[model samples]
Target chain A: MILRPQLQDIKIIGQYSGRVILGLGLLMLIPLLVAVCLGEHAAALDFVIAASFCLSAGYVLILICFTHKEPTWKHGMVIVSLSWLLAMFFGAVPLYLSRHWGGYLDACFDAMSGFATTGLTLVQDLDHLSFAHNMWRHLTMYIGGQGIMIVAITFLVRGAGSALPVYVGEARDEKVLPNVVQTARFIWLVSLVYLLVGTLALSVTAFSSGVPAVKSFFHGLWVAMAAWDTGGFAPQSQNILYYHNFTFELITISLMLLGSLNFRLHYALWAGKRKEIFRNIETVSFFISIMLLFGLTAFGLASAGSYPGVSSLFRKGFYQVISAHTGTGYMTIHPLQFVGEWRALSLMGVILCMAMGAGACSTAGGIKILRIGVIFRALLEDIKRTMLPRSAVVMDKIHHIKDIVLGEKLLRQVALITLAYIFLYLLGTLAGIALGYPLKLALFESVSAGANVGLSCGITRPSMPAALKITYIFQMWAGRLEFVSVFALLGTIIALVRGK
Target chain B: MIGKNFVKIWLVFLGISTEIMMTVFIMLCALGISWLISGGWR
Candidate 1:
């Protein structure tokens, strides 16, 4: 029997959701300041209106749903899912006001894409986009990559006990520190340090590429945010290719791989647990899988004679493999070249890498290396047990931060999540195929959206069917949240409508 | 005190450098394998 949610539950969820919204409203001021400093008065005004609307709505919600009680797990889950949807709407305000999108829906799609760190874009005249709006777009990736709930917990929310559910709801379950707040701060610390380092490296590379000093700095900062978050937005429409510098591509690829690593692993490494890098299952799996996939892609492209020599193949083909594997989607090749030039085998290799993404509890989405590693170990253990005598026992353990036993419960959970991702990929593919896309392109785009890897096959544009855009949006949101929070939201809605 | 802080900073840098080195090595390996498969040696 389902119990209906009480008024108190609603109040708790609403109050926390309002706090998240208020925090988002405050974030807009950063870009607003950027616009003012750049003397983009028209763009500044758009942010002003959008910020005011967010502030007022947030304030009103807090007042209407005032509560002193801390959020329970249910309240936290509901708040996270609800706040993400609201964040998409509010975040889209300035984007819509910029008059670059075809409609509010297009803005919303881009907003959701940014927040989910999915990197798909639907804006027009992207090259001519204002500096402030571009700042906001990349900022969305930074915020979403760190988990929006984390920002609120670090800055706004007071109670640590209440922060855990929302933190877990954002698909960040591993706590690097003992306390949730401490973990949030630690996550921020790691990101900030990397941000400083990554931005400087990219900026120098860009400057060497002959971009002007000021443009190089901003471009470096924006790309650092996108790369560090594994959110593949670039300042210019050409993405990393605009610089045409191998050094820049190398720096971004390094950052993308760094971003895809588990934050806990970063903590361990920073704390001088260097051996963990070698012993860790995720890193080992990532190395093996990337090498295997790159081999496939390289052979496929080689057979097709897509590139003339090994140098071009390594430069273009290897970059795409790593980009896809890390879910960064920073394309050197144009989007159309994916379908028009690349053969099916190469596309399949990229798709597999996107599906088997890097690191659990990291910014990169998909089934995650941790789950894949565990499942593989579990299969080996089973095989060993079968080959041995009936009385023999096989025990398998894998190292993350520490050695974790391969248990049936863990395997079941891993299998379920992997299946959910496959289902999502299939769902988005069906949507695309229904709209007259070819099977290969549909599957590629579907996995791209569902895995939050923003690689496109020329199908994502302003003119894509409205339904397809919405489907991809849902896919990005659900994929980023790892289905737990979205399912919790759905269960809540069902309880509201049909509960006894 | 400055020396201690320097060591700490150096350790952090070293940690990041190690990760980057590992990434570069893996990428080089992948590149090398691809080179072999694509008959780059030929």
Candidate 2:
């Protein structure tokens, strides 16, 4: 029998979600201050109006839904799913005010894309966008990458018990520290350190590459946030291509790769367990997968004679493979080049890389390497079991942060989530094909969106069908949350409608 | 006390450097293969 959620459940979900929205309002102040300082009066006005709306709405929700009760697991899931939608809607206010987007829906699309760390964009005249607006775009990536829940848990949410479900609901299951709050803080510590190092490195590179001093600093900071977040948004429209400097690309490659690493691995290394780098399953799978896929991509490009020399091929070809594999989506080549220049084989390699993605509990998206590694091990165990005697036991284990026996329960959970991702990928591909895009291009863009990798094969544009845009938005949201929380949200709606 | 702090910081730096170097090595290996297959040395 399905039990309908009570008013108390609604209160609990509303209270926590209100707190997140309140936190989101506070976050907008960073860019607001930037606009005021830069004398971007027009942009400052947009942020002012948007921040006021968020603050007002957040306060009203908190007041009406006031509750002292701690949220149950169901409430936590509902809050997370609802909070992200609220974030996308309210977050679009300032963006819509900027008028760079075609409509409010377009603005919401970019906001969801930013929060999902998917780099797909539909913004027009991106080059002429104001500095304050640019700051907000990349800021969403930073906050979203670390997670909005992490910010709230680290600063706003009290009690580890309350924070845990929301943290898990954000699709981050592994906690680096025992307490969820400590884990959030530790994640912050790592990112903040990388922010300093990455920003400084990129800033110096940009300056050396001939960007003006002030512009170089802002560009560096923005790019660092995007790359380390494994988000593909650039301050300029051309993305990494705008720099056209090899050193700049090299720095971004390092940042993106580092960004996609599991935070638990980061914690392990920081705590002096250096050997974990070599022993960890995700790293092993990542290394093997990248090499095999890059070989295929290289071969495809080679047979096509896509570029002239080794330098061009390595810089252009290998960069995209890393970008796709890490879920970073920062393209060195133009979008149409994938369709026009690269053969079907190379595009397929990139699509497969996007589908597999990078580490779990990090900014990168897709069916993470941890699950891929486990599934592969499970397959081997199954093969061994078939060959052995009837009474023989196939002892299967996976070495993640530590060695763990792979039980039936674990395999079932992994298989379900992996299937969900495959379904999400196919859904978007069908939507693209329905809109008259070719099969290969449709599949490439769909996997890119569903995996939260932002690479485009020239399909994403302001002019695409609204149905396609909405489909991609849903794909990004569902893919980022990993299905469970979204299912909880759907179940709640069903109960609200049908349950006695 | 200051020396101990310095040593800890240096080790963290070293760990990060190791990760970066490893990634770079992978890229170089890929580049080498691409070079060979594309006959770039010629």
TM-score per candidate, in order? 0.98, 0.98
lDDT of 1 by residue, A1-500 (tens): 98889999999898888887888889999999999999999999999999999999999999999998898887888889999999999999999999999999999998999999989899899999999999999999999999999999999898799899899889887889889999999889889988999999999988887889988899999999999898889888887778888888888888999999999988888877899899999999999899889989988888898975777887789889988988888899999999888999999999999999898878898889888988888888888888889987667888999988888888899999999999999999999999999999999999998998899998999999999999999999999999988999999999999997
Give the TM-score between model 2's chain B and the true chain B: 0.78
Ten-residue segment with the worst summed lDDT in candidate 1 chain B? B26-35
What is the model-wide C-alpha lDDT for candidate 1?
A: 0.90
Which is the leading candidate under TM-score?
1
The DockQ figures for the candidates are 0.63, 0.63
lDDT over C-alpha atoms for residue A445 of model 1: 93
| Shift of residue A251 alpha carbon in model 2, Å | 0.5
Error of 1 at B28 (Å): 1.5
**Chain B alone: TM-score in each candidate?**
0.85, 0.78
True contacts kept of 1: 0.52
lDDT of 2 by residue, A290-336 (tens): 98998899889988989758888888888999999999899999998
Candidate 1 at residue A497, lDDT? Answer: 95
